[model samples]
Target: MHYAVYFPLVFGAALGLLGPAAATRLPPRPATWLLTVGGLVAAGTTLLVLAILTATLIGGHSLLAGHLHWSPDVFDRSNPVPAVVGAAAALLLAVLAVRTAWAAVRSVVELRQAHRLARTLAPGDGELVVVTEPGPVALAVPGRPGRVVVSAELLRTFDAAERAVVLGHERSHLRHRHHLHHLAARVAAAAVPLLRGLPAATSLATERWADEDSTAQGPRPVVARALFEAAVRTRGAWPRRGACLSVASTDTDVRIRMMLAGPPRRRPLLLLTTVALLTLPVLAGGEALRDAHGLFREAALDAPMHSTPHPTSQR
Candidate 1:
């Protein structure tokens, strides 16, 4: 509960939100690494504090009893402020640790598979089919091949230029390796649960990020038209699944708005929000520790027990 411990844990949680946000706006290369490091540090700090408190409680209780005797199957438990605070710290650390572990596993599996999948397709003069399914679709799978997959039905959905635009859109996804960003954001969030709000923010940012990437090639209307047409054609699966893992899965309204808006404001708002929110838990934890320590010192010696100073005759 010391400020040292609280600040790190809270800050870790706050930092957790940043990765996803950054993933959306920035490419995965630098941003993902930064977020991943932050999560590791935060989780480590949280676990360290919990471990310390757990050790203190176990040792303190044993010393109080002065022997290792199991209590007789007791149901009622005594309330002690230090013990309660210690327990809470321990629990919080445990949850964060578990989250980190699960996320680590997920990151390794999904991203590796996606990357491997990306290797299967190499875009040439013609398009490819990365995953076998029937629908109007086009998306990028990042790798050396970096597929611009299109379904048979999708080829008939639009004219040649529109088809090219659709392919261009998916190509932009591959160029940016947007799927990797999504995967990293997901993993980082799992690794650090405190940044729960991050995914939504990052998802929004990346859509804008890719929209800008697409517009750099041609007019926004071209990409917009292609997106709308392709989306409508595959309206059924758009709600349920990822089509060939190329299309950047995003909210319809948000993606359309980004296309219309033409890019982000360049404000560091999400990052700033993360920084501001992370400070809170850390402050609370530090204060809690200070208060607990001061209270212990004040109460430990102030209370006086009744004492008979004079020697008494046999009675």
Candidate 2:
């Protein structure tokens, strides 16, 4: 087979390098979707490439034995994939599968734990929780009925308008199910290390999504001020357990600038560019598989056919 079989690996590397930059340029909602979808595609293509490679090895061995009547030595010499390489690929695939499973299970367990804690704290009221604590804390806890937990310090730190902004931001997190997006990104990254950029990028996008939602609810300045004060108060403090989404979690400067700049305008060109970048990998992978299949067929056809002597006596 030709090097087309390696296209998926190359495409994955390109995504690892460039996906984050593309994600950052788009508006928050689209950017979030881009990260989630791109991450999934990248990881899935990597697995597909590995599967193709494994199939090539098996098909080559079978063709040489059945069609060409070739010895193991001849088969090994003719095949593009060496024994060591095929074995290594198989081993790597096993490792990735195990890791992906572990990550998925761990994520589910943690999410359940977070939900249980949230229920224990505020079983009566599913919407909001006001904790009496000296340090500032604000977070959206995802559960059966998601809750926005804010510390008394945080409540005292902001006026009614600022409180509205804070609540609005956390509510957006719950409404949009930002935690699931984050979990999906994490699972994809775990499956393929090349997709590691996605989880962080998605986190930023979700935070920005909430920031924009808060801005929509009230004055931009008030939302920005609320974010700034929350960050200042929570600086260096440990984030609360079950805090999947929080006002103070992301980069304060970037979030503040985004709010002050007003809502993001739709950028058709940038969106199209991101879509193209993500689509390229799938196209390349499909083409590679096609080429690899063609090569395998050609190899099979070219194999020497041994014909048995006909029954001359019977004729």
Candidate 3:
């Protein structure tokens, strides 16, 4: 029961922490691979259904065929309850995987489109600045004079400190190449959807990282304040749609709360957590191997042991 619960959770945590890094690095290609390969994987799923059917026909599990068998037990038996529960979990995970992959795909398309548009949209060789969006929006379009955008609404909503913080946030993002981080993150996820959370965590961390640099002017709260204010004012205004920072879809509450709280306090606690995160896979793999060995041992014990036959000399 403990393994049943904790196994997936630890797996999820691993994905959560690792996902963002991948998302930040190679987002689009990974996402595309996930979609294509995922589709191919779906085709192979019939093998699972066939395996289950064959299992039912063979009258339960066997090891070494006639040489070994496992004693039936409540948990050891192929009960429908566990099967149903497992199926449900698999389904949920599949949905999550698909959603995350799609998001990466879309982000890639949008970002690339933004890049192409930047050429035509370029205002000619100065620090990158955007003027189209009405609300708060910040984008990093590559090339010297690489622009960092902020919506008019954002400027109207925030004080000078907050506005400066917002600009700085975008600047930090550009300077640190957070977009590349995002691409990496997406790539990792596309490579493995079970690792979806990896990208998500990275994205959150990068956003925070950018916030830290942008708000370095005295109070970091000013940056957080700007993010919250922008989200509230923009209502999820995507720049492609002629709008900037729209709060319509942003995690306004979460961003604001983080702003108020400021950055997380670093402590040795994170060291322990990092250790656990790094070691969890090995632990999980070990546990799985242990369980498999145990099952096999039981099967071996149940099967008949052969006695050595004595060879008779010519009598």
Question: Which pairs clash in model 2?
Answer: none
lDDT of 1 by residue, 1-315 (tens): 344545666576656644555655543333444454455455555565566565345534533323433221110122133667777866765776687678767766765665565554543433456444666656665555656767767777677777766676667666666665556556556645676655555455555555556665567877777666666665554223222343445565656665776654554665565446545554555565555455434433343334666656546
Q: Pick the candidate with the highest TM-score.
A: 2
- How much does candidate 3 score in TM-score? 0.51
Model 2 lDDT, residue 264, Cα = 82
Collision pairs in model 1? 3-286, 6-282, 7-282, 17-195, 20-202, 24-205, 24-206, 140-246
Report the Cα lDDT for residue 210, model 2.
89
- lDDT: the better of candidates 2 and 3: 2
- What TM-score does candidate 2 reach? 0.82
TM per prediction: 0.61, 0.82, 0.51
For all candidates in order, the CA lDDT equals 0.55, 0.77, 0.49
